[model samples]
Target: MKQGVLLIAVLTLNGCSSISPQECEVGDWFAIGKTDGQQGIASSKFRSYQKECAEHGLGSDFKAYEQGHAEGVLLYCTYDAGRELGQSGGAYNKVCTGALEPTFRLGYDRGRKWYQAESALLNLQKTLEQNAGTIEKLEQRIDDNTRELSVLKDKQQKQNLLDENRNLLQDLRQLNQMQGQLQRDLKQAELQFSLIQQGG
Candidate 1:
C-alpha cells in the first residue's frame, strides 16, 4: 500500500527538494514555504519540530485534531521565530543547504532547545488553565456589569418622577375606588412597596 502524504509543499520550493515526490508523499504532511530567516515556514525548522514531537512521545496514533494542535503550537513558534529574524536584520542569516537544492534558510541557530516532552505537555496544560481562568473572570465581570447597569437603569428611570409618581397615584386611586377585599389587598401591596422603597 502507498504511504499517504499530507505535506502541503509550497510551489516556490517544491523543485528544491532532492526527495522524490514519492518519498515526500510518504510523510504525513509538509507545510512548505521559504521562511526568509524573516518569514514563512522554512524547511529545516519543520523537520526539527517533527523530530521534537516524535521525541516528546506525542505518539504516532494521535488523531488529526491532536496533530493539528501540535502543529499549531509549532506554527506559533515558527511565526515568532520569523518575526525575530526580521527584526534582527538577518541576525541569523539564511544558509542554503543541500547544494543540489537551496532550502529557504530559517531556524533558531542557537543551540536547539527542545522542552522535554513532559514539559511541553505541561505547558499546554497551563495554557489551557490560564485561558479558562481568563474566560471565567471575564464572564463574572460581564454579569456584574449587567447587574450594575440594571440598577442604574432603575434609578435613572426614576428621574421621570412626575410621570411615574403620577402613574403610581393613578393606580392607587383606581385601586382605592375598587370595592371590598380587592381594594384592601391593593392598598396593602402599595403600602408594602412604599415601606420597602423608603427603606422601612
Candidate 2:
C-alpha cells in the first residue's frame, strides 16, 4: 500500500494522473491505479485517451497511447511480482482487459479495411482512366492511318489515269506519222506516171 501510494504520487507529480471532471480533453494521459480502481480510470483516463486519439492523427494517438501502455504494463508487472515472487500491492493482470477493448478493436479493424478498399477503388479508377487515354490515342492513330491510306489510293488512281493518257498520245502520234508517209508516197508515184506519159 505504501509503495503503491508512493508510485501514484510520483506519477501524479509527473503529470500522468491529470484528470478532468467535466469533460475529457485531448493531449492528456489517463492513468489507472489500483488504489483508484478501474472504474475511475475508465471514466476519466480512458475517455481522455479516446478523445485525444480520435481527434489526432493515427501515429500521433499511437505514440500518445504508448506511454499509457507502458504505464499499465509496469503496473501489471508490479502487481504480478507481489502475487508470484514477492509482496507488492498493485494490478497484476497480464493485459488491461478493459470493457471497451473488444468493441474499439472491432471498429478499428473495420475502419482500416474500409479505407483500404476505398484506396484500391481509387487506384483502379486512375488505371482505367490511363488505359482509356491510351485507347483514344490508338484510335486517333488508326483514323489518321486510314485517312493517309485513302489519300494514297486517290493518288494511285490519278497516276494510273495519267499513264493511260500518255499511252493514248503516243499512239495518236504514231498514226499521224504513218498518214504523212502515205501522202508523200502517193505524190511521188503520181510524178513518176506523169514522166512516163511525157516520154511516150
TM-score of each: 0.21, 0.30
Residues 1-200 of candidate 1 have per-residue lDDT tens digits of 22332233432245433334343334334223212222333445545434444665432322432344344434334534543443344544333324311222333322111112223344545555554555455455545555555556566654554455555556545433443444454456555545433531
lDDT digits (tens) for residues 1-200 of candidate 2: 44435545654564654333212322233233332332123223445545544554321233444555555544443322223221112232224346534443343444444444444445555555554555455455545555555666577765665565556556555655554554555455555545533532
Clashing pairs in 2: none
On TM-score, the candidate that comes out on top is: 2
Candidate no. 1 TM-score: 0.21
Q: Pick the candidate with the highest lDDT.
A: 2
Residue 98 shift from truth in candidate 2, angstroms: 5.1
> Which ranges in model 1 have alpha carbons more than 4 Å from their true place?
1-115, 154-200
The superposed Cα distance between candidate 1 and the true structure at residue 172, in angstroms, equals 47
The global Cα lDDT (0 to 1) of model 1 is 0.40
